[model samples]
Target: MNIEDLRDKDLQPQLDELIGSLTRMWATMLDCHRQQRAIIKLVSRSYNLKISFQSESQRQAALLLSVELRNLCSNFQNWMVAQVHETSEEEEEFQETCC
Candidate 1:
């Protein structure tokens, strides 16, 4: 569709694309999470490393954690939309039977 035509389009397809893109982005972070956990285990295994939340790296960890949280929220939204769309489609089919 032309740019002018696209402006008036509904957001269903856009949202679907968003869901696909977000899934890919979230998958990339899985390796990072695994590495982080491994780091924690390695540190704990070597010395009696005291875990403290007062570090700057902990703040960075919080930021990374938030990204995963956001992805969970996005996936929930997409699931909701897909359910709604399925319901609407079923309703349309039912209406056609009344004719």
Candidate 2:
């Protein structure tokens, strides 16, 4: 599809779908981030004493916590990308059906 050949009216449905998808994604992401913060706080509190004590157990817990948080961040990123791709595919399908 040539960008120059596309009309705004013809693109409205896809645009609307994309906007709706984005709004939903944003809300979901916000909730997920909030939950992530809570989890991090819980982990931090559990390891807080360990941090000051500087024991092998504390080091292990800290390492594991960091890895878990990293994985969470990676997974969230992948999910967001997937949502975008899914929206695009849906838009394509919508266009096919309507036209």
Candidate 3:
């Protein structure tokens, strides 16, 4: 469909749904991160107790995965914010033109 066919009012509901989904996803990600951190702590403790090779390997892998997840979440948040800002600006412009 053409841009002219797309109206902000028509898209608002979908946008709201998307925003809601993103918000929920973000909250879930935060909870997961907290759980991951807790698990990492437990693993680290396990590593410290006996210094087993497998425990150390597991701890390192967990740490790397946690960092990767954190980075992904940060990037997703930044991208989401940019998308919302851009959509708002477009809506404003559309309104101005329509009026």
Question: Which candidate leads the pack in lDDT?
Answer: 2
Per-model TM-score on C-alpha atoms? 0.42, 0.49, 0.46
Query: Per-residue lDDT of 18-73 in model 2, one digit per residue for the tens?
Result: 76887688779768867876876676576535345369898789789778977986
lDDT of each: 0.63, 0.72, 0.67
Prediction-by-prediction clash tally = 0, 0, 0
Q: Which ranges in model 3 have alpha carbons more than 4 Å from their true place? A: 1-54
Give the lowest summed-lDDT range of ten residues in model 2.
44-53
TM-score for predicted model 3 compared with the true structure = 0.46
Candidate 3 local lDDT, 1-99, one digit each (tens): 766457455686786787678667766866775676577557646643543446878979877976886676577657656766776686688679756
Rank ordering of all candidates by lDDT, starting from the highest: 2, 3, 1
lDDT of 1 by residue, 38-62 (tens): 7655744754444557889996896
Candidate 2: lDDT over CA atoms?
0.72
RMSD versus native structure for model 2:
9.4
